[model samples]
Target: MSNSGTPPRRLSTGGQPPIKFLLHYVVEQVPSRNGRTPCFTAWLREELASGQITTWNDEPIRVEDTRPEFAIQVYDTTTPPSQDSGGDVDQRLQALAKALHAETRGEREGPPGRDRDRIDVWGLPLSADLSDEERIATCKAHLLAEIAARDGGETEFPIERIGNSFTFGRALYIIDRPPSRWDEGEGGILELLWDVNPGYRAMMVHEFGEKYETYEYEPIVTRVTRAELGNQWLMMRHGASR
Candidate 1:
């Protein structure tokens, strides 16, 4: 946060209007004292710089919001973002995901995709016992290997997560190869489904809003090649008579 930008204006006490403070979570126009605003601003910057304001566990500050010089009426207020607001959707989503992932709230906007059309790709099993951190690490590993096995493994190529959404709950990785077989009239699809669950609440966080899809069926699957299978296979023989 460089001070190269426009300086924050001093607020008024009696006659002047409230100055707008545009925080990422909420927006507000607040009135400040004639003198203490400078002190408060400096203190806030210091607190942020010292890794105090951002952390999950922080001690309460001694500063008071109530006073003749510093007082606010409303508990909460918000305003719509105007054009040329310079707001960042990615930053807001990251901040909200960091906060909301730990909470048990919010609603899903809709299904992940049109019934059975999307979210069909799969990979390794994500154990329910694993934490979110563990699951993400596992996903990164699986995706890395999958890409390395394909032409996309090149370092210069663009690689991204299947879907950049904040998801939680018990889920497993099922590579989409088997479903392609199922659609192709292959008989082995049932073997892959033995360990698979009935369904999962596939929740996701997006820039627009939160959404979820009842995940069950997928269309595509990774198909193993005959050459790869033959090299590892051994022919069996037996002698019936001496």
Candidate 2:
């Protein structure tokens, strides 16, 4: 997408105060052909150009527009007269730098280790043995149960059937809720992709936090490929059926 308005102003580190850098990205849709028909591919790009600081402490910090694709060293402290004297300042600067890095990189701070094993969505292994119809039924049932278990009950889960994709051999479902009802830092919605032929299931929960906005979901199963189902549908419709 084309940028509008003035480019952001560059950050100044002259004050020696800890800097908080905020990077914003615009989601753009670029036209491409999946086969014969034209489709739009969505991607994130830096929204501003001039706001980026190219060099800090004589070290090059690359910023493509506003995207933080490079490492940033934000801490600059000279040797203290005594080791213990500057300990507090060093620690504080380190923490601030870490936080800023996480924000710019759009990192999600969550519990370590994989959450996939805990995702027994349908109480059945989404194995290749199960039929497509059976998988779909199980997924729907699981979604219903999840909705009922939430705070707002079934009303909270506005399940939308996104239909089948013959190309990828999967059926999609979206559990959407209003932004108001969604708790801060909590995933507001769930998306399920059930492979029709292989019977493999992948699920993602959309999450948001104070510092960053991410389009990617927190996956229940790690190996499942992230996809834009809408784009996939367009591809399938345009004679790219798998």
Candidate 3:
């Protein structure tokens, strides 16, 4: 399975840069060569589950995505192996995802990311006496920062909402705070519904009992306190119609 740790650890070569590698996973549809031995998909998993992850110089490989027939994984043997920390961190998996990324055939990368997933977290500890507009400004500054992030965070693209589908990048959040529902100086919360479109390309995979095509319509939930929203909002800067 996948080994993304709690709060999902961020993997960038900050300090004591660890050895990095890439695991290209893809299970294509191909016929057996001899029509004899069982397909690698059947028994290959057994071996992987049995503590056999790699084959490159005996590199142990683990398959987690839907398909498990054919996978193309990669690694960089350039950097020397870092010291093991009592086996808590699997160097092998680390090698695969320490800084794992993807470079599709025709898609252009955003900045420092495209081949990987990036989370944008903003922390603000402003003065308590700031006005609501000032707080909104703080939130806006944070949103702008996130939009300009080198990795995959918020994008400059507008967040267009039509009925149920919201454009991938958020536009702006319309705050509807009920005045009678809260006391003065008391912080409130904003709940946003984000309909995420992974991309335009179509990926074929197995579903139910047959092959079904599905687009990435993953809806994610995010909570922002009035204190955290700062003075600004997460709305797109320009071209944000509706």
Candidate 4:
């Protein structure tokens, strides 16, 4: 929500210039009022599925860090709606450039201690050329195995195959909602394991689950791949770590 008493900025007296807004999301634990709800993720899923709000791509917008529940579906609204699509094109371009740079090590920093279940995905078409579905399935299996091994028993963690796109000679993937237990250290090991041994990429998730929580210990895979990693790196580098 916007700050109180902060009047909406208008581009004109009676009309406004075309403007776009950035939506920021974060997970916050709220105190339940009475016997009101389950976890935050469960409550959010109900809100999104209720059809009370429009999504971006006719896909459900969610907050869960687990499968299906976190799978995003977008929808568009005409009234009080989003800005024109033109602006998003440039934004997407900038994002892609940043992603490429970070992947190549030009930008090598990321956030720390965010030991929550999060997801990071990297696409190097030449690495394995695996289809998005194959990647998700392979990764999910790997993660499940890791969870089982760590907990010392059988486990079933939610996993959802999000969506994919082809760009810059690579196939891009977005995992729906990653298991809430994933951390940066685990993400790094997974990336490295996949990068070094082509056949073992499928099991990298498990490797990470067995070790560190933030540092990237391998050259093949690093910690800068997580979506939230960049921002964290910036914050700490600038002495603004939160």
Give the per-residue lDDT digits (tens) of candidate 1, residues 57-153.
2544322121111111100001113311324422332232222211211111112211110011121233446554454445445434534454334
Q: What is the TM-score of each candidate against the true structure?
A: 0.17, 0.24, 0.24, 0.20
What is the C-alpha local distance difference test score of candidate 3?
A: 0.29
lDDT at position 185, candidate 2: 40
Pairs that collide in candidate 2 are 167-242
Best by lDDT: 2
lDDT of 2 by residue, 1-242 (tens): 33233233244577864333333323222111122111111112332244454567898643335322211111121223344344454343333333322232212212331110100111122444554455445555644443344435333113222223232343333222223433334332233433332211221112233223323322221111112322333432232433
Q: Which portions of model 1 show Cα errors greater than 4 Å?
A: 1-118, 152-242
Instruction: Give the TM-score ranking, best first.
Output: 3, 2, 4, 1
Better candidate by TM-score, 1 or 4: 4
- 21-138 per-residue lDDT for model 4 (tens digits): 2222222221222322111111111122222333434654343333222111110111111332534533332343333323322232333421122122221112235453454445
Each prediction's RMSD to truth: 25.5, 22.2, 21.2, 20.2
Sorting all predicted structures by lDDT, with the top scorer first, yields: 2, 3, 4, 1
> What lDDT score belongs to each candidate, Candidate 1 first?
0.23, 0.30, 0.29, 0.27
